[model samples]
Target: MSGKAIVAHANLDPYERTIVVSDIHGDNQGFLETMRQVEFSPQDALVIVGDLLEKGEHSLELLHTVMRRAQAGNVYMVAGNNDTIFSEWYNDEVTDEEVHDYMNHRKNIILREMALEMGMSWQTLEEVRALKAAVPKRYAAELDFLNSLPHILETEHFIFVHAGLKPGPLTEQDRDFCLTAKAFGTQLHRFEKPLIVGHWPASNYCETIINVNPYFNRNTNVISIDGGNGLNRWHQINYLILHREHIDFGAYDALPRFRALDSQEPSKDPLTLGFPSTEAEVIRKGETESICYLPAIDLEIPVANDQLYNYKGKRYCYNMTTYCLPVQAGEILACCDVEPRGLLAKRNGMVGYYTGRYEFLSSDDLLLKKEGKQP
Candidate 1:
């Protein structure tokens, strides 16, 4: 089958609390702190909504923790998009050429760490490539654990998935969509039970973090808990605590110590994602003073001719020199006027940037756009 089946199920006692988290993205400190705060015990149930690896310095540590808890039968996990990518590598489903391509696209960090732990110093690209070839043989057990993860988890009153499900009977939902879906049509909300998903951040559905105390929803019943954990400056890791009668939020401040590891050296040139040289030249020549709207904050902010400004405590500037602007949901940012070269925005605080026009759309609007339907 193209998508994995729902491999596990659980029936919680009526009085037991189920604490669920999504998109940990390898923040071991944040995960540990959250667990400590919640006083997570073996008796209490913990469900993680996937994306347990990548983009952080402690990917292996985080995976070990989850595997240990899971083995004890206290944790249930549903695979996220990132988890699926690593699974492919572990299963030997990808060729060396395919793995090399993925490594080039800023995905070598995970493999490099694994190689180091195996007593190899992969200091060069070629060494990293060599390590990729040995992954399936060296990490067979770990790969098996990742492959065994289910796509969905269900309770009498709630559905736990890595991503939102399609609008219809739960049994009929596509496995791939449940693992990686970011936008869902209103039809998805018509289902009888509330859904909890994590692939997309809560910022995509709400304009501000202050407004997300209750929950952020593309649909009223589909609550998203991905607090752009490792991806954004302003947002922190978010966890949702579910009770029989109510839900609560558990947020951990970003670990500045760990976040510093992700900082990059300043780039002299503007970052462009596959834009042709000729097209980029045109954008620079035609760049003009424009007022770009901050859809998340519902405010219109003016971009200077060629300077950075502080919005919501973060600095933003339009690179007339380059077409890309580093902006994500829930942050106060100055929008750039790069129409032809395309704008860069962060999706759920993921490592890579998503290239698209400088247009803001909520998850619901995004669903309509993807479906070729009017909202």
Candidate 2:
């Protein structure tokens, strides 16, 4: 009942492989498909590093799926910051004013969705109290699963936490920090084993290029596997698989696949590899878009100025890419964003702006085209 750090030690020897994933953010389909791509089996153990219950379209549904799987066994989950915050609200720890603000921009919140499903609303204090009690009683299993989730999962070779950790004894680490650690990847920590984390997307750690793949910092033995799911359409669920002393990563998303129709031409100007995936300082703020400079890569790019305010004194650009894409004929990619600048596409885990010819590599599109109709 007292929201605190519950560190758990895991033994994955029984399974043929130990699969680690994080920041699922309620994308149940993407999670399942990523496992399918990796050929997930009963023989494999899955460790969802965290953020399993919020942000995507199916927060509560994803929770049920994870609950069912965990009940079936071979599945372990850690508490993400979103899960922790929700727990705090549910336990009456959050003040009325705080809850009001939290529920203000209500979108994809698990608790809100659960209440809505039962024809309940939390706009008023009476409604909040009534639904809070009713929700847990009706969905006792889901609540219990969230309540029982650990903040950290440890093994001989790896230490899995939703967010990052402070360098020290695992038990003494701050509960909230472990649940919502920021920039833990950049922080130097010499753990005996590799520390795997989510919450913070792996691409944000990249300064020069856009890579949603797991980031392995050999120097610190820290591996970040949050592939920016739920943050944007381009991002996907990153899977970290450990098998036979080898570690690999895979990603899956809901974006439609496509193939290049023509080869890339030579660029006259300098090649912009990609935009800075992390934070950037605002240089010129525009009405619709602002120019921000990312000190990590010394690149200035235009970003959507759609935020009402900054969180934790940190600002981020959701859409910022100036790199031109070069694609060979037949190169496969997933369509991410489309703009007058070019089609923003991700190929081989790297995202870039493509001006070249391309076609949707989908049967649905083919079917529509075969009927002589524009899709």
Candidate 3:
């Protein structure tokens, strides 16, 4: 997950609002252009949904721009699947060569296949590899920030997630689904809030289904701001503005400002999972004596520390402790670097903070029975 900077007017007068965007995908130039075109006011808050790299010519440039925006306290970002892959590689967990291999494979297979389906000239593996090599080391912080970012954000009236929730026990999975282009069908009206997603490219036939029509149902808020960069058909970026009262939109009709950082596609996995969802849960029935466990992925084994039990599961690694609350199924937890701080989410309810993993409850089976909870 990347760092987010919130910008709002001190008074938040009637016109003050936040602007949300989907999948910049390295279109930093377009992003700036769109902001200028929309006459972005300092009073506005800009939130980028994620997937800002991996398919453009100005990834590093875009990264610098994003950091400047954050530093200026104007913009924030949620980690997209594409951003996840770049983060791992930026952290050196995945090498540049390995990324190139994946991109070459994707180019030769998936991308080419899609191009053929669309009757367009296929982008070659060489072109993709070159694009990856073009990424400079200057964007390291931005990439790390992207990797460390969260999947969802909450405001007074709306909730912003890179990907929407999935009907499962995993919270990250839902976010990942919302960050990709897989399901833009007849089932877009399922979510309760105004879901702003990017990842899926724009399509004429699927326009109504893909993008949220906030005008029809002021309450039925669903928006897809990815204007489909990196293709022969479209070259625009959409920016959405929303606040307590209403919402609006803007678009940038220029080429992308950055290059793809690597050939690897975004990570398909979501980052939020494994914990409680409320402050009350963290405060509930905690023992005086405390222990914590940081869960591990299948490849990483959990190590016990004090009362902490680092639980390595089939999917993700999480921390568990006696001080931690029992985790209900479908809850996603993100451990914080700040001592005694971790984020807990039950389905999609309000996100909560816990002191340690001891508060996590783990039975052989945990069942989740909610549509969406907080943090």
C-alpha root-mean-square deviation, each candidate: 13.4, 4.7, 21.1
Q: Which candidate is the best by TM-score?
A: 2
Each candidate structure's TM-score, on Cα atoms with residue i matched to residue i, is 0.64, 0.84, 0.49
Write one digit per residue (lDDT tens) for candidate 2, span 1-375.
333478999788778999888888878888778888888888899999888877888888888877778766899988888876657866667865676566666677887888879988888777776776687678887777888889989886788998888878888888888877886888876777888998888777765456778888888988988888988646988888897457987788888777778877533343232223356678998765577777666887776555323546776555454666668889887877655445677877877777877777677743234222223
Task: Give each model's whole-structure lDDT.
Answer: 0.58, 0.76, 0.46
Tens-digit lDDT track for model 1 on 85-189? 666664567755676666566542566567778876454557656786677788777778887888888877788888777766666777878876755422345
Between candidates 2 and 3, the one scoring higher on lDDT is: 2
Q: Arrange candidates by lDDT, highest first: which order?
A: 2, 1, 3
lDDT score for residue 113 of model 1: 65
lDDT of 3: 0.46
Candidate 3: lDDT of 129? 47
By summed lDDT, which 10 consecutive residues of candidate 3 come out lowest?
276-285
Q: Put down candidate 3 lDDT per residue, 1-375, tens digits, no spaces.
A: 322222121223334777777766666677787778777787777778777765765655676688887876666677667667655554676666666576554432222333343454424546544544433343346445665577766555655666554533223354435455353422345555566666654332232122212212233355555556553223456676666657766555532111111122122222222222101111122332222222322122222222232233322122222123334433343222122233322111111233322322332212211122111
Give the C-alpha lDDT of model 2.
0.76
